[model samples]
Target: MTYAGVNRLLHWLMAALILGLLTLGYYMTYVADYGLYHLHKSVAVVVALLLLPRLVLRWFKPWQSTVKGKGAKAVHGFHWLLLVLLVIMVVSGAAYSGFGGYGIALFDWPLLAQNIDAQQQVVAHSAALSDWGLAVHIYCAWALCFTLAIHALAALKHHFIDRDGTLIRMLVGEKGARL
Candidate 1:
């Protein structure tokens, strides 16, 4: 089962990082300066990188799902959907950074850009790609936000109302979550 410690560790790490990204994304979009821009890019790049291994792990290792029978499909489907949205978000973010001319970096190392000149290092633009990238990034982010809300609600229902240990399985592991 993918419920091993490494998987849980990765899941929580990504969860915290993604949530931080969401908050940082919102703050940068509406309130702050370019100060956090590099931080945002750094974190995003890490998440993007981390996604691949997590995906591979999940794909190969069968999950011991807490859900059963009828409702399991929806829950499982939603889980996969979250991963799909993550891919979209990561791709679009990279597109925007690279094409939007803002560029990307893992903290300080530049990842994508045509030229790294003094005046036009990462600021060179390809108008179309930039705009499209930004549009998709923003829209998909909001869509992801709503989807996460629903996921959280369902988890809460399972834990608090249903007392079925679904949330426990998610937080811990399937075996550990058993009541």
Candidate 2:
């Protein structure tokens, strides 16, 4: 079976958003641009908002798998794990930024107040809390990237190797028979 249109749309949209966010996150950290932190945090909040609805929709309107037996089971399990990891990442990111004492902004609107001084110094975070949040956020992001890679590889395998309709089902819904 294929996912519903809403399901397919959410899946693809979230895939893009997550990928973009991951790239931004990496660039912000490794590229040494501390200024990108605000943009990153804002986009992250958008991701969290989108994910909340997607999770609820998935729960209420579960999709039937075209793949039977063990493959279906594994796919279902992986989806759940991915969702959990996403939630963890969102929470950790929020804590890392929020507790850092800099106000979070969406575009130009401020969600949290920027409590910096004339010296542009942010409010102090406890060593333990900030460290834990940063570590969890970073680890979860890497885990998500790895999980997404596996997910894409599986879809490719089903489409090319197994000659299954799984990928097509996701792309265009359950209109035609399994290819």
Best by lDDT: 1
* Per-residue lDDT over 42-127 for candidate 2, one digit per residue giving the tens place of the 0 to 100 score: 88888888899889987887667667899788878898899999999988876776776766788688887766878988874554
Candidate 2, residue 178: the lDDT equals 47
Report every candidate's CA lDDT: 0.83, 0.82
User: Estimated TM-score per prediction?
Assistant: 0.88, 0.89
Task: Residues 7-78, candidate 1: write the lDDT tens digits.
Answer: 888888999999999989999999967799889989998998899988998789855566789777887788
Model 1 scores a TM of 0.88
In order, what is each prediction's RMSD in angstroms?
2.3, 2.5
Error of 2 at 22 (Å): 0.9
Worst 10 residues of 1 by lDDT: 113-122
The number of the candidate with the highest TM-score is 2
172 in model 2: Cα distance from truth in Å?
A: 2.2
